[model samples]
Target: MNSDEELSPFNSFQFWRVPLPELDLSLLETEPSAGSYIAPSTKDLEAMET
Candidate 1:
């Protein structure tokens, strides 16, 4: 059971059984600043629709 075998999606049971990394709760507590995020332009949105 190598790291590759553990991570392979074809081995569904083994893939899901692998333990997930710990999450940082501090990130969730922090407030998002204004203009921190950028949205896709209308031109990009139109291309996606097609």
Candidate 2:
């Protein structure tokens, strides 16, 4: 199959990673909250979440 024929489940820059640009401190109380992360694809997230 040709490149154009291939389906893209991602953005144009598929190689670029997902960005987590925001975080709220108010969400956490006295307890220490965990870190935040972003995934390039749902497939990656599913792999980790599972």
Candidate 3:
């Protein structure tokens, strides 16, 4: 009858029923946001070649 009993890892009957935190899905949004992406400069690219 207890919620904890249903969610406990010790309970083999509900081992897969443990609650999870809400996922951060902002990155999956269709629209891009400010600071979400950045283009590397020519100098930065050249340094990677070395």
User: How high is each candidate's TM-score?
Assistant: 0.28, 0.24, 0.30
Q: Model 2 over residues 1-50: C-alpha lDDT tens digits?
A: 64753645443675567777788978766755477554369788788888
lDDT of 1 by residue, 1-50 (tens): 57986667866886568698999987775677685776889999999999
Instruction: Single out the weakest 10-residue window by summed lDDT for candidate 3.
Output: 9-18
Per-residue lDDT of candidate 3, residues 1-26 (tens digit): 66996667776666556688899987
Per-residue lDDT of 43 in model 1: 100
Instruction: Rank candidates, TM-score, best first.
Output: 3, 1, 2
Q: Comparing 1 and 3 by TM-score, which wins? A: 3
Model 3 TM-score, 2 decimals: 0.30
